[model samples]
Target chain A: MLPMFSGKLCQCLSVTRFPSILFLGVIYVAYVLVGGLIFWKLEGCSCITNKYSLLAITVLKMIKAASLSGLSPDSNDTADGFWKFTSSSVFAATVVTTIGYGNIIPLTTAGQIFCVLFALFGIPLNVVILNRVGKYMLAIERNFSLKMMWWVLTFLYFVVPMLLFKEYEGWSYAEAIYYCFITLSTIGFGDYVADHNPAINYPEWYSCLMAAWIFFGLAWLALLINHSIDLLESVNAYMRRRKNAQTQV
Target chain B: MLPMFSGKLCQCLSVTRFPSILFLGVIYVAYVLVGGLIFWKLEGCSCITNKYSLLAITVLKMIKAASLSGLSPDSNDTADGFWKFTSSSVFAATVVTTIGYGNIIPLTTAGQIFCVLFALFGIPLNVVILNRVGKYMLAIERNFSLKMMWWVLTFLYFVVPMLLFKEYEGWSYAEAIYYCFITLSTIGFGDYVADHNPAINYPEWYSCLMAAWIFFGLAWLALLINHSIDLLESVNAYMRRRKNAQTQV
Candidate 1:
């Protein structure tokens, strides 16, 4: 129940500090608390992480019970074997982008320390990489029709990969497209990871190539979005000036 | 092992495709694979999630053994108690910002679905939020000294929180600053969580408020970083033009 007009016009003009904090408090409850609860209810059913509290399931029947209820899965159900080559490539992509899906994270003390240091170097390096590629792409963009560029981008990053994933892993088209969007946007929910299974024999070179593809793809998306934003801001400025001119009349 | 000099000469070069894809492939190897390995070796020690192979230890003893080692703790070691207010706040913050630091991810099928939908709404809303706040901040920035504003931002977002976290959670100053940097920059490695401890009796309201603080903090950082990049690009463009003019002379 936010007033949406809490600025300048306070309910109690002399005492607004408490109200500001109170407003934040309200947002926390209405937004975070409720949202978390919904997720908790939804995700708790399949959670294998809470094994300690589920004292009802005996050790003898644990495996039998877990399989019967698709919800009781080991955290390693989709684990990248901690260091398998293909999944490791995916891990590297997520970290550099700052998306860090945490699907398969550092498991050792040394690993944690390394993650911090590598991310420190990798994060900035990634930005430089994005900026470099973006500069080149934007320059070349002028020579080609914008629609044609988008068509290529869509086919190369989305349609093509979606088909490959569908064929390679049997994921539906929507799931593959969703994965591409999530990864490129750096949302990286870590749900639809590809070739993470230890049973699969995904090529190391393929994973290596995938990393570059993900980075370049992200840079292109950023360029398009940035261009749109610039256009939007200019239009806004033009509209504002026109309104101001009318007001003067 | 990227040559990084494929530009200028490649505009007229035959078969330019190899150089382009090759550059990205190189980045994938030097950046992702090597970085992933370093993290694996460093963080693998405390990775309690790799329990299947360590079968000599019983499940109950495994928990105890891992707890004693401090490095082999469960993934839910500081879980948000399935939706406890504070952890949930952390969870919500991670998702919307696309940090998705699977430190405390939803384990249920339903939760994952909710997360996808929530992110669709939340990510866009977050950007709109940053845009709206950025507009106001930019207006104010025009009137104020850049250094002063930066100082204020530093103290408000980083310094104050660092101090409070140190006091409240007994974390070192460096740790607090690290957490602030990781979370605000949206890297969110999830190695050093604040209230993930079950031993503590932190209030739910406090955690809820923490989420709002984190969101606003990230938005401010984004605005500041965006401004800096814009300034940097303009300077770079000016310098390049001067260099080109000198060549003509």
Candidate 2:
């Protein structure tokens, strides 16, 4: 009985950790493929080396990246037998996270009321989510200090790409990183949005390919952050338990 | 020595909490008076109904009510200096909290990178902030056992004025709440923004007055949520410690 209980506990933990990670992975790949295709079609026959083409490629990259890092709400087990597709919790999560993506906005009076209510609910929900994430982060720091790991990983993931983009894509290192951050954060201020390169006429397929790359890149960045947070919290929690046990003895 | 130490601690606590609270209080009062005066100058024409005047009066009243009852942020220092005012921490808190009032956005490439870094920093900062807030909320819940306090407070602060505006000012309840939420959240979708009511004749002064109200009202809501979270977390932590100590014996 004890073995079965422990096994169930381990299974539950693994399930929570891995399912979302895997799901996000699948979604991101799909997003990259689709977004890339669309951008290729849209920007093809345009100047690939021109400023407009460069901008188009950058924008497409952002879209693919964002789609990959998308978040979904945890499903609750309620015996009520009625499926609530849009629970208040989930709605709150989406809006507060700024995943606005413009997919949903309140159109009616009730809808608007619900929107406000959702935000109201979301403010705390965000807090709760962050708390859990924090716990995991502390765990990681205990095992392997996050500062050191973060610096190393950031160098590989962000700094390297930034330099490459500057050299090959004609962006300044600062500009590339800037674009990367803005898109990943989903601010999408649109002030410095990418435009198609006007100089080089590329095929439609190539244009789409560039677009897919941009979106997928952003999505991956978001995913990396989420995963890191989870890992950190898990490590922190384990350390805390160990310390507590030692203290009690 | 013990007495002196306790006294000093109390003093420190008061210094942290009282000043901010007083500052916010003063701001709230000034906002109401200035807002009311502006409305009076701009829209208090002879053609307007007494109800319109009353509605304006109640708007001020609701603002006050909301300020006092809503989740208020710690006017006091509940955490160490390491967590407070760290640029990265502040940026994270500001973004994740959706206080995106547009007072600031990434202006330069460096700034954008900073923004993303902040978002990364923010995920952890959010955890700390939420845990702190949750403790306070738990305390309140224990004392009152009123699970609906937040809901009730939200209704009074948000829903009531919205409903009143709909009935007296000829807005649909949905529209009023939508206006309230969008303005409060600072999402400012700008899709359904409020213009001058017929009574106000869309005057410049009225427009300015409305803008001021929107800004302050949004600040008030944000502060309220921050406060509530802190309160809940403090309470929760205290309880958890107590439980642990009891178990140790």
- List, for all models, the DockQ compared with the true complex: 0.10, 0.11
Best by lDDT: 1
Per-residue lDDT of candidate 1, residues B177-235 (tens digit): 76777677676655556666555777667575566667568767777667655664565
Error of 1 at A3 (Å): 52
Instruction: Write model 1 residue lDDT over A1-249, tens digit each, in one string.
Output: 124233322432325234433443354234323333333333333323222222323442453443343334344443323444434444555665777655555443334444555555455545644775675566455444557877888788888888878877777776777677667767765555666544667766656556667867888876765665566456555765676688699
Tens-place lDDT digits, model 2, residues A1-249? 555545544543465444443443354344334433332333232323122223334443443344443332221222111112222222233355443322223344444555666556454444444443444443443345446866754675467657755654567767777655554454433223232233434455644443444444444454465576567556655665675688699
Compose the digit string of candidate 2's lDDT tens values, residues B1-249: 555545544543455444433443454345334433333333223232222222333443443444443432231222221122232222233354433322223334434554555456554433433343344444443344355766764675567667655655567767777767765654543334354243534445544555455544544565566776677567656765676688699
Docking class of 2: incorrect
- Cα-based lDDT at residue A231, candidate 1: 63
Q: State, as a TM-score between 0 and 1, how close model 2 is to the true structure.
A: 0.39
TM-scores computed on chain B for all candidates: 0.62, 0.34
**TM-scores vs. true structure, each candidate:** 0.55, 0.39
